[model samples]
Target: MIRTATPADVPVIHAMVRELAEYEKALDEARATEEQLREALFGERPAAFAHIAETEDGEPVGFALWFLNFSTWRGVHGIYLEDLYVRPDRRGGGHGKALLTELARICVERGYERLEWSVLDWNEPSIAFYRSLGALPQDEWTVFRLTDGALGALGAPTR
Candidate 1:
C-alpha cells in the first residue's frame, strides 16, 4: 500500500535517500538532513511532499518525494518527482510502480497536467523502468542548475 508520509517517517526517508544516492554513485551529494526534510515536508508552509510504500504488514519498503512545479505553457501545475526509491532488496515487488501510481492518482484528482522527473543517463535499469511506464525522454532539453557558490555569486550585487 502507498500512503502519505507523516512526521514519523522522516528518519527512514533520509536513510533511503542516502541509500539511493549511493546506488547512483553520488552518495556525497546527498547532503540533506532529517531536519531539513521534516521542515520542507511538514512545515507550516510546506514546499514538498512525500508518500511511503508499505507492505501489507505495514513495513515501509519505498518512498516518493516530490513537489509542485508550474508549467507556463500549460498554465497548470505539475508534479516534479525528486526521488522515487525502493530498497534494493524490496525492488521488483511493484513498490516502485505503486509509488508512481499514487502520484499519478494525485495528479488526476487535483487536475495537475504533468508528472515529471530526471533519471541518470547511465542508469539503464531505471531508464527502462520509466519507459515501461510510458514516460518518454525529453532528449532535446538540457537541464542546468546554479548552486552553492555559483548561486550566491549570481545573487550578489555587481561590482
Candidate 2:
C-alpha cells in the first residue's frame, strides 16, 4: 500500500534516503537530518511532499520524494521527483512502480503536465523500468547546478 507520508515518517524517510545514496555510491553526500526533513516536509509552508510504500501488514518498504516545478513553455506545473527508492531486498515486487503510479495519478488529478526524475547513468535497471513505462530520456539536455561555495560566491555582493 502507498500513502501520503506524515511527519511521523521522517526518520524512516531519512534512512531510505541514505540507502538510496549508498546504492548510488554517494552515501557520504546524504546529509539530510530529521530536523531539516521535518521543517521542509511538515513546516508552515512545505517545500516538498512524499509518499511511503508499505506492505499489507504495515512494514514500510519504499518512498517517493517530490516537489512541484513550473514549465514556462507548457505553462503548467510538473512534478520533479527528487528521489524514489525501495529496499534492495524488496525490489521486483512492484513497490517502485507503485510509487511512480501514485505520482502519475497525482500529476493527472492535479492537472500537472509531467512527472520527471533523474537516475544515475549507471542504474540500468532503473532506466529500463522507466523506459518500460514509456518515459523518454531528455538526453540532449545537460543538467547543471550551483552549490556550497560557488552558490555563496554568486549570491555575494560585488565590491
Candidate 3:
C-alpha cells in the first residue's frame, strides 16, 4: 500500500536515503538529517512531497520524494522525482512501481506535462526497471549541478 508520508515517517525515510546512497556507492553524500527531511516534507509551506510504500502489515518499505518543476514551453508544472528507494530485501515486490505509479497518477490527475528523474548510467537494473515501465531516457540532455562550494561561490555577492 502506498500513502502520503507523515511526520512519523521521517526517520525511516532518512534511513532509506542512506541505504540508497550506500547502494549507489556514495554514502558520504547522504547527509540529510531527519529534522531537515521533516521540515522539507511537512513544513508550514512545503515545497516538496513524499509518499511511503508499506507492506500489507503496514511496515514501510520504500518512499518517493519529489517536487514540482514548471515547463514553460508546455505551460504546465511537472514532477521532478528527487529520490525513489526501496529496501533491497523488499524489492521485486512491485513497491517501486507502485510508488512511481502513484506519482504518475498524480501527474495525470493534475494535468502535468511530464514526470522526470535522473539515474546513474551504471545502474542498469534500475534503468531496465524504468524502461519496463515505459519511461524514456532523455539521452539528449546533460545534467549539471552547482553544489557545495561551487554553488556558494556563484551565489556569493561580489565586492
Residue-level lDDT tens digits of model 3 in 23-48: 99999998999999988999998989
Candidate 3, pairs of clashing residues: none
lDDT, candidate 1, 1-159, per-residue tens:
999999999999999999999999999999999999999999999999999999999999999999999999999999999999999999999999999999999999999999999999999999999999999999999999999999999999997
lDDT of 2 at 65: 95
Model 3: lDDT of residue 138:
94
Error of 2 at 130 (Å): 0.5
- TM-score each candidate: 0.97, 0.98, 0.98
* Model 2 misplacement above 4 A: none
Q: What's the best-to-worst order under lDDT?
A: 1, 3, 2
Across 24-47, the per-residue lDDT of candidate 2 in tens digits comes to: 999988888999999999999999
C-alpha displacement of 2 in model 2, angstroms? 0.5
Please give the range of 10 consecutive residues that has the lowest summed lDDT in model 3: 38-47
